[model samples]
Target: MSTLGVNTGWRARAACRDHDPELFFPTAHSGPARAAQAAAAKRVCAGCPVREACLRFALAHLPHGVAGGLDEDERRAVRRRGAVGRPVARPGPRVLARRARAGGCSAAQVAMWLGVSTRTVHRWTAGGAA
Candidate 1:
């Protein structure tokens, strides 16, 4: 059920591709369960040939869950530290809104990550200015 699109090359080589995706979106909010889930996901990234590429992709495209061996918080710290040059602008607001919703996080959360207002995110989602 995989769709073809950008990053297909690196993604094809990703080790996590063989595992359940929910593993990357840890069900637990915090404490032991969350740590275990993140550890499990990171194990997949530990040996991935496309690990760097995946990390770069996550830095730009992912706003929640575990990706490229790091959780969303970790990625946020990385972004703040300016450790990578990933572009966070490839997807327009609408696309990001859909992705945010699909990821079980609010578009407002995504907008916060991107330094925009929640109302602005709502406007983007509705295809209008608020």
Candidate 2:
């Protein structure tokens, strides 16, 4: 099954499929070592047929790895700039309700977790808003 709405069939055509997975997950701090590893992984991505799809998936899911020739920092820049011309995904009302029920949390607590106003959470719970 596809994870995070990504098409896993693309993996078969990815150039990095046979490479070391570590090359895609560099440390947080930037340095020569990280740069080299990321560059190597990017080289593979540059030749992959599904590079665009991989990047889109990474941007949507915020995965921790090099994808579509971009490392974490590059992906963060894309997200911050909204370069993809698509709105970032947000948790829907059903997700909020599930979290509240699973955690036995109140609307305010759910709002805090969702980074939305408590009134928004209340509205969602009442089915007046998403």
Candidate 3:
């Protein structure tokens, strides 16, 4: 059931429901502890059965948290690529390169597959950003 074009049922199944809200919304990037805090938040989201729903909700309503295992940058990347409802994992470089080459594609083309920047594809292909 939805009150305003949003189903509330998913909250019952969210992994962070019982966790501290601050865990998902670390306050500062400059702080040395922020990275570790975000990682801890993400670990909770990593196994969430409702991750997709959470991402969609985050994209629509929540602007500042680790919903669906993604931080602000990742969510921005998803939004910039017009993939509002679909959450996708980064493509493995070897597999993606083979497929890209098979299609006669470029790094930009590969980035399109995962809603990331061309630079991100390069990093992924270079064996980084997993």
Candidate 4:
């Protein structure tokens, strides 16, 4: 019963909780092993009651691995489709600097929050370039 309405206790009922963590995060060079592992993980996710919540969380924060019966690429596709009607504008350097100063966060933290790169945040913070 968090603010997100995701039951924390639901994790105890997850099938993959006791499994190897590596199975969920396959590398690009994994080849067949990746498919096999993703399938296995998806099977586990299929029976989880919090599957939707898991997917939403993955799309927002995890950014990698097989979650809620979908892989990273699948989640990325879902996000793209979800944003089809609404275009997101990138924050300007002044906005980034303001957020960093107000939150007392580092360039890397601000970059991650803005979905940019650490180098980009550095340039913005340093007033070098946009």
Give the alpha-carbon lDDT of every model: 0.70, 0.67, 0.70, 0.63
Q: Write the per-residue lDDT of candidate 2 for residues 9-126, one digit (tens) a residue.
A: 7777778888888778876365444544565676677679878777787878866789876777778987888787454343454664454534456666566555678887766676
Give the residue spans of candidate 3 off by over 4 A: 1-4, 90-130
Assess the local accuracy of residue 129 in candidate 3 as a C-alpha lDDT between 0 and 100. 27
Model 4: residues with Cα > 4 Å off, grouped in runs: 1-9, 28-30, 83-130
> What TM-score does candidate 1 reach?
0.60
**Residues 1-130, candidate 1, lDDT per residue (tens digit)?**
2323445477877999899998899888875456556656876876899877788878878899888767898899889978786533234446645555455556656565545788776766664321
Clashing pairs in 2: none
The superposed Cα distance between candidate 1 and the true structure at residue 72, in angstroms, equals 0.6
The residue-by-residue lDDT of candidate 3 on 1-130, one tens digit each, is 6746899689898889998888898876733245445656777887799988888877777778788878877788888999887646754445544445344456766565445788876665664222
Q: How well does candidate 2 score on lDDT at residue 26?
A: 78
Number of clashing pairs per prediction, in order: 0, 0, 0, 0
- In order of TM-score, best first, we have 3, 1, 2, 4
lDDT for model 4: 0.63
Q: Residue by residue across 1-81, what tens digits does model 4's lDDT show?
A: 453554456566667788898778876445434545565576677678877666666767667899866788777777887
Q: Model 1: how large is the Cα RMSD against the reference?
A: 14.0
Q: Which candidate is the best by TM-score?
A: 3
